[model samples]
Target: MKCILFVFGIIALLLCATVQAVDKSACSQPHEIGPCRKADPKFFYNSEKKACEDFLYGGCKGNDNRFDTKEECEKTCL
Candidate 1:
């Protein structure tokens, strides 16, 4: 009984870690500017600085790290 409980606890902890990792995966993406000539301003979470920073984004394909506002980035990443 005690061993079973311990195994269950370990499994729960691993699941929590995996969920958290998935949730934060977008925040872990590097800032991408894409291959365009647009100067649209955007915000992204800087993992190194642990804060949202602004950057000019192209009007094409980019990663999920882009956000329209710093508040939105903070809400998602922080």
Candidate 2:
């Protein structure tokens, strides 16, 4: 029983390590421009600005536009 538990623990550790490696590769890269607001309420990709821009501006009276994922936002914007 003890041996079986030990093996299971090792396998779990290995699986966790593999998952970490994959996540590291996926989230390792950095973004350039960062998050920006292109539209108000709803946000979309802004290729030219390099930063997310608000959908609405100038006293529109709405939630501030921002990207949830900084890296993604920067990557798309920048």
Candidate 3:
């Protein structure tokens, strides 16, 4: 009985490890328009354009493709 319980516990742990929570917005293309900084330089990964494009944030509209650098955006999204 003890051995069976231990195996079950291990299985539960493994299952938990396999499950990962992903942000749909971040991965999705077609960014939003608000909640960004204009002066703050950033790179956004455009899935449709299939490239990291430089954008001037309106300080109130943008999507989850926000990145600090173009390379960083490609590394993560591309």
Best by TM-score: 1
Superposed model 3: Cα runs more than 4 Å off: 1-25, 33-37
* Residue pairs in candidate 1 whose N, alpha carbon or C atoms collide under 3 angstroms: none
Deviation from native of the Cα of residue 27 in model 2, angstroms: 2.6
Instruction: State in Å the error of residue 62, model 2.
Output: 26
RMSD of each: 4.7, 10.3, 4.9
User: How many clashing residue pairs appear in each of the predictions shown?
Assistant: 0, 13, 8
| lDDT by residue for model 1 (26-71), tens | 8999999989989899999999999999999997999989999999
lDDT of 2 by residue, 1-78 (tens): 999999999999999988756544422233223344443233434444544543332233332233455565444344
CA lDDT of every candidate: 0.92, 0.47, 0.67
Local accuracy of candidate 3 as per-residue lDDT tens digits, 1-78: 999999999999887655422333474666554664456667777777778887666666566667778877776666
lDDT of 1 at 32: 96
Ranking by TM-score: 1, 3, 2
**Residue ranges of candidate 2 with Cα displaced over 4 Å:** 28-78
